[model samples]
Structures are given as C-alpha cells and as structure tokens.
Target: MMNHPVSPNAPTASRAIGPTEFRAAMGQFASGLTVVASLDASGNPVGLACQSFSSLSLDPQLVLVCIGKGSTSWPRIARTGRFSVSILAADQQEVCAALGSRGPDKFQTIPWIATAHGTVRIDGALAAIDCRIHDIYEAGDHLVVIGKVLDLATRQDGDPLLFFRSAFAKGLAA
Candidate 1:
C-alpha cells in the first residue's frame, strides 16, 4: 500500500475544492425563497428575488440579506431606508421572476400592498417582514444588509418555494 499525506486542515474528500470548482459541484442546499422589496422616495416600487434571507437574532429581531453591489435594486433599497421582505410561496414563481428582472416596470405585473411604513409587500407571499435599515457592511462583492424588524405577518398555510443550486425547488416540511 502507498502512504498518503493529509493536512489537518484539509477538507474531507467529500467536500468540493475551490470556489469556482465547487460552484459547479452537485448537491443542492435548499433555501427559502423571498422577494425583498422597497419603494423609492417617489413611491415607485423596486424589488428583487433573493434566496439569501436569514434570521440573524431574536433579541433584536434582526434579519439579514446579502445584496450584490452591482444590483440595481440595492441602490434603490438603500435610498428608501426601509424595506419589506416577502417570503415567497411555491405558487409565486411569476412574482419572483418579475421582480428579478433588470429594467423598469418590474412591479407592473404584480399585485402588492404597501405597508404604512412605505414598503411594498407582495401579495400572496408566505410572510411579510417590515424592517428599518439597521446596518450595512461590505462583504466581498455583496453587501450584508442588516435590518431591525419593525413588524411581521404570516399566512397560516402555504408551501414555501425554494431555490437550490440555481434551480427552483420545493421546500421540505420542517
């Protein structure tokens, strides 16, 4: 038998190596999908589909989403000072695609209700979270936006949609 060397810090053989290489690797980690939306100062709505939403802390009622620096919606969201996160249900794929597009009139095709806080909330979403901008920090090519949840509402029943490995999938029961 031949001897093999392994570094202690080396990842398990099952782990894919390198960011670019691992990007192409198989195996899907399902994420709850959402549309992060806001209305500009002029009351025009802007939003984008994001699977990066995460619960950060309970004490402060904090939530986080990673927005690409190059995203058009980020600049618009930054200006608003507040935003609404609408957790997407499985049937809301059309709403997701519409908001994810590049260009104007992204909100034209969707039905939404604006919160008193001035954030646009997409209709039929699994849940809606209204937040005020807490902190924004630079993280690689993305900005990690931290929000302080001001209000939250949820629908009693709905199957959540999921995004995994660049494809649309269904959420599993918790």
Candidate 2:
C-alpha cells in the first residue's frame, strides 16, 4: 500500500481534547435526568443517577443509557439482566443527588417501588420505563447499554428534570 499524508483538519484525524473542555462542551447540550435502577441478586434495590439516556428506536421499543465503566452500580444491575429508568421531574434534584452519591442505602431516603417486572422504579418520577438488557457495547471509558423496553408508565405530570452546564437546570420559562 502507498503511504499518504493525512490532513490535520480531517474530521476523523486524531487530536487531543482536554477533558475539562470536552466535558464543558458536552454540558452545553442539555439532557434529561434519570435514575437507572434494578434489583440485586440479594433482592435489594440499587441504581445510579444518569443523564446519558435516550430513546433508540420505536418499532423495537429500545432505549439506551451510557454508563461509566467505573460505575459499581451498573455491574450489579447488569447481573440481573433488567433495569428500570425513572425520568425525574423538575423538582427532583434531591433524588438525583441521592443516587449520584457513593454509598449504600441510597434508597433509604428516596422513595421507590418494586415493579411487577422485577425492577426498582423511583416514586414520583415523571415517567418510568422497565427494560431488559438487549445489548451492551464497550466504548471509551463507558458502556453503551441498549435495553428493550418491557413496560412503561407515566407516574406524574410535571416538567422534566434537565442537566446543563454541569448542573441541574432551573425551571423553564413559561
């Protein structure tokens, strides 16, 4: 094969991006806040606060959540092969903080319910989606988990919680 020089300006060209800069840039894109929860092998509830979640497909009823590789909760949840995604309401900042923290008993202070589908769903959320793990892909420092939605319910009527610029967004203007 003949060697060819690649242009530095090429979109796919390797380049260094500062972690802080990348994070900040990503923060510019607002994302809905959610909690991904499931029952452990011991029948205990466990979960994590997440913003990296989205709907992937309609016909297949698929959803996706990007979980950090370092997340201890994901492994535990993964073992069960099922989980629930609770989309937070705009007033649920405390719920997000509780799950985002490092400790056991996150559910001790937060309100949650056991779904008939064998997943843990947060109470008072805007919506809850129960799913079975469809597939998992290893990406750079994160695992992209694709879930096949088994069932879903709208728990409350309210504005969705949002994250932007590394913090929870204030209420939207009416």
Candidate 3:
C-alpha cells in the first residue's frame, strides 16, 4: 500500500468522510441558535432552527443563513423574499427544539408575532432582525441566503443559546 500526502491541518481519512463524522467534527465549533422565519404563500408562518447564521457585511448591513434544501421553510422564505432571524436566548431551548423538530407545525406551539415586514418573529428572543432576501447561492446540499437587514430589535438582557458537540449550552465567562 502507498501512503498519500495530506496537509497537517486536514483530517486523515482513508476514505471519504461520511455525514455523521462530518457533523460530529463540525460540532466542535460552538454556534448560536437562531430561528429563521417567513410567511408562506398562504400567509402562514414557517420557520426552522439554524446554527449556520452570521454577519457578512457592515456597509450594506448584510447577514446570511444556510438553509438545507430539504427544509420546508426554505421554499416559503425563497418565495416570499423576506425573513426574520430570532437569535434564541439561552432560556429558549424549547423554542429551538420546537422549530428544529420535523413533522409538526412549529409556529402553532411557539409564541411569535408577525412583524410589519410580514415575517414572524419569535417572542422573547435575545434579538430579532427583519430582512429582505438579497441573494441566494446553491452550495452542496444547502442554499446560502444573503439578507439585507431592514429592522431589528434587541433585549438588553439574556445569554444566547449555544450549540456544541451536538448539545445545547449557555455561554459562560472563563
């Protein structure tokens, strides 16, 4: 057998990394939980919990969230061209689970109100940001959605809900 040269920073893989391993490895990086929501064609709220959200640009006030192609909410958000991201508070674990779970009307159980922009905002979140869809790009099995921020609100208090190693946690000072 011959050895293959690999970068020191890259994981040693005899074969292609499977989804489980990829997910596990990526989970080492802690991320804040967010609920990306929008109204469907029929004017009903739809949303999903996501960790792949981040600020992209300051000049245009741009942010982005990666939505899986399989997500039911993404289609609605794409059609509506508007969305709101609710950064979950550390106490809102139930809200995270509710929106993340499958085969249920997530909004039916969670407390949310429609914003003036026609997107749903999760109540009692750490912060809520309303945005209009700026652009979208296909990336592997997910779509990277860029948003232009329109309006935002924040509560002065509360820690953010964080995800790491496939579990939820509250941030703490070292």
TM-score of 3: 0.89
Give all TM-scores, in the order shown: 0.85, 0.91, 0.89
Per-residue lDDT over 29-71 for candidate 3, one digit per residue giving the tens place of the 0 to 100 score: 9999999998887988899999999999999899999999999
| Ranking of all predicted structures according to lDDT, beginning with the best and ending with the worst | 2, 3, 1
Task: Report the lDDT tens digits of candidate 1 across residue range 1-174.
Answer: 998988898977675468766655643666878889998878888899888899999998999999988898889888989999999989999988888778778988899998998898999999999999999999999999999999989999988887878778755568
Between the candidate structures 1 and 2, which one is better when assessed by lDDT?
Answer: 2
**TM-score of the candidate numbered 1?**
0.85
**Model 2: which residue pairs collide?**
none
> Model 2, 27-93: lDDT tens per residue?
9998899999999989999999999999999998999999999998999999999999999998889
Q: Point out the higher-scoring one by TM-score: 2 or 3.
A: 2
**How accurate locally is residue 85 in candidate 1, as Cα lDDT from 0 to 100?**
93
Highest TM-score model number:
2
